[model samples]
Target: MSTEATQPYQRIVQDVRQKIRSGLFTAGAKLPSTRELAETYAVAPGTVQRALTELRTAGLIYSHQGLGSFVTDTASETVGGRTDDWMPDAVRTLQQQVRDLTARIERIEKGGD
Candidate 1:
């Protein structure tokens, strides 16, 4: 399915994040230009720009104005004293998953399976 039809900016942010997290976009490496990502993903450059903005806010990447955005080194100091946005979401998701699993196990033990 063409998931890009909904939430284009979110999809762009996710694609870039996945690439960085997967090591496809490396630390200190420049990301695809807004024009390039927009063309490749078949979306407007504004959408790509919004995605880049989100990444910058999350501290996973930064821009150089004359240059392009680059993946920030994990150990490097963050821009604007921020932490990556994905980190908190992942931690919460894991916590919720653990709780769900415990509840499921309790149900199974109680013969609710």
Candidate 2:
């Protein structure tokens, strides 16, 4: 077996992905900040940002401007998974309501009842 070195940012992406898949960082769990992740992984913050970008593009995590990143449901992107204990019930409820309303509106617009 050849020992090949993966790119630093890709390594971050893989590790985080594995963690999420293994349920260590289950859906809606807040990921560590870029700075913290950089320190933990001993990589530059920019590298962490790149990994985060990849995750975001893949729909694995979502971020709010000041709130930071949280994992999304990898199994079904349309429905949000369970959130962290610290996440407010109202926020989760509101998110679900929005999704439901949007889906209803879409169906209506398509004349699909």
TM-score of each: 0.62, 0.63
lDDT of 1 by residue, 12-109 (tens): 87777677666687777888888999998888999899988777666667666656777766513333244444578666445434544564576589
Q: What's the lDDT of the predicted structure labeled candidate 1?
A: 0.69
Against the true structure, candidate 2 reaches a TM-score of: 0.63
lDDT of 2 at 11: 83
lDDT of 2 by residue, 9-108 (tens): 8888778877876678876688999889999989999999899876765556766555677776551332235424365766655554454456457658
lDDT over C-alpha atoms for residue 97 of model 1? 46
Q: Give the alpha-carbon lDDT of every model.
A: 0.69, 0.69
Alpha-carbon shift of residue 43 in model 2 (angstroms): 1.1
* Model 1 collision count: 0
Error of 1 at 27 (Å): 0.5
